[model samples]
Target: MPDAVVSGTVYDGYGREAGGGLVLEGGVLARVLPRGYSGEADVSGAFIVPGLVDVHCHGGGGASFPDDVDPRSIRKAIGAHRASGTTALLASLVSMADPLPAIRALVPFCESGELAGIHMEGPYVSPHKAGAQNPAAIRGADPEELAAWLEEGKGFVKTMTIAPEADHAMEAVRILLAHGAKPSWGHTAASGETAAQALEATSRCAAELGFEGVPQTVTHLFNAMPPIDHREPGPVREFLAAARKGRAIVETIGDGVHLAPALVEDIHEWAGANAAFVTDAMAAAGMPEGRYALGGLDVDVREGAARLAGRETIAGGCSRLSDQLALFARRGALPFGQIVRACVAVPARAASIERAKGVTLDFEPGKRPNFVVFDRGFSPVCVVRE
Candidate 1:
């Protein structure tokens, strides 16, 4: 006998949707029934998608991850994103002089299963493209510091963002792979050739280590990097090309503020499942427009966009992954199925959270039930996890 059943329009975490009913048993999806099958809960027209996975997010709910080390503040941030339907998340910390303390602070959450892992977005990036990062903290790649941070993470450091053009950056990439952590290329001014070289190095290293199917990502593509020019043709061109070929998964802040709807649509058309949508969200997400902190910098939020105080450089996002889904749906940029894959499956695969034991986000038999029910407007009506 089933513990419970939910009948609705169901979307497999990949790119398929059907009208059916899901049977829950022993805290897992025991069966998926065809349409017209009656159930204990009938959602009729609502849309059911796998719970969202955010690979890059600083904080939310009025708490900043990089600035707060308390477990309570961390839980507050996790609770905020979780309320918006993000079941799997990586607590991203910005560049700092020494990140071991912060990495230590986040490892408990990873052990307790409250967080998927930790993402360190660099002290090893190009100063020329630092974006909102504090300039004083930026430095050349240091393999020693990288190893210390990863060791202190206790195997919970899943990703680190590095600039391909930074000194000894390739060495740093090799170190991350050896430590079972993936490298994300961003905050860079690297030329197209340099970007291609880094991608090849990561691929070769991953293959040598037998780490097949593990994703190498471009952190929030086109945000801090140089724009593509016909003659110059910087890293953006190479990153997009890699994404189109499935060689890399590119993270796009699809909040409508970071990327125009048309550009987002174009990227999706080119990259398809390889374009992963991420929030890169900060403390202001789910909160009223006001002051917030993203690392060492103070930010002011107004009109739904967060920016550094007294500057125009856009800070991290103030929208959740669900809000990005709604924005893309409203723009009619891509099919709802594709958008769901970008927000759910792609990021999960990139972060390897989909492979975590007892945590598959699909509605497949024997997999734990982790999903969100959204109305026609794409607002989350119900979120379920087991």
Candidate 2:
């Protein structure tokens, strides 16, 4: 029996959009009805899509996850993203001298379901490509430190970004996989050959642990890494090649600042389902442009772009996933379905939190009612979660 119904242009998890109505019973989708079906709510002309899942996000609503130890401040950030239609997300912590305190502080949220998991974006990255990361806190890969952080997380640590060329990088990958966390490569100065070797080694480790289907990711591809030149291809080429082969997922900040629209389109065309969209947002997201903090670094947000206080390096993103989705929809550079897949499906799969948490990316029967409604302009009208 249907307790409620929402009719509109519905987008399924696999990027298929059509005019239909979703029947809800007991807080789960009971059935998907055809177009023009009478329902409790007739949201005609609105777009209905799965609740967004952001795999990489630092903070929002004036709170910095890497700097805040208070649960109130952390919840504020989570609320900000949730209001913007990101129902699932990973709280990202940047490189700091000691990450254990923050890791312990965030574990409760994970347990309480406020956050899907915690992503440590490293004290084990390259200094040259540190970008907004505090170089002083960056260190060589240490398996012991990684193990301690994972232990404190209590199975809530989802991913960690490490440079492929960092010392003991392979060991760090093994440790992350052993603890049920995925490793993402970024903030590196590794050559193409070194990047390829790292991917091969990571695949071998995952296979040994019976986790071969779970793919490693590349952190915000092309940012915090060397550019691709015809003569010197760098790691970007290797990462994209792996993505094409379905061996890895590449994250792209489609906020129109981290990457150009044309480049975003190109990568989406090349990587398809392997490309995941993320905000990489910070404390300034959903807040007015002003001063903010990411980890230990001071940042200034102006014109919707967050940057280091006095430097040109981009600190983090200010736009939410909804904002990015709107931008892509307006541009029409890629199909609307493709954009949604990158925003919702791919990221959820990358984090491997959908099935584990009973969160489905599609409006399937017996699945939790997690979705968002948007107007013609792509502004979020309402968010629903079971």
**TM-score for all predictions?**
0.95, 0.96
The best candidate in terms of lDDT: 2
Best by TM-score: 2
Task: For residue 55, give model 2's deviation from the true position in Å.
Answer: 0.5
Stretches of candidate 2 off by over 4 Å are 1-3, 36-45, 356-358
Local error of candidate 1 at residue 27 (angstroms): 3.8
lDDT of 2 by residue, 1-386 (tens): 23667777788766787557777777778888786665567344367888888889999999989998798999999889989888888999999999888988998889878789999998899999999999999999999988998999999998899999899999999999998889999999999999999998999889999884555999999999999999999999999999999899999999989999889999999999999889999999999988999988899999879999998999989989999899988999899999988888888888888764424476768877677888889999877765
Candidate 2 similarity to native, TM-score: 0.96
lDDT of each: 0.85, 0.88
What's the lDDT of the predicted structure labeled candidate 2?
0.88
Q: Report each candidate's C-alpha RMSD, comma-separated, in the order given.
A: 2.0, 1.8
Stretches of candidate 1 off by over 4 Å are 1-3, 36-45, 357-359
Separate clash counts for every candidate? 0, 0
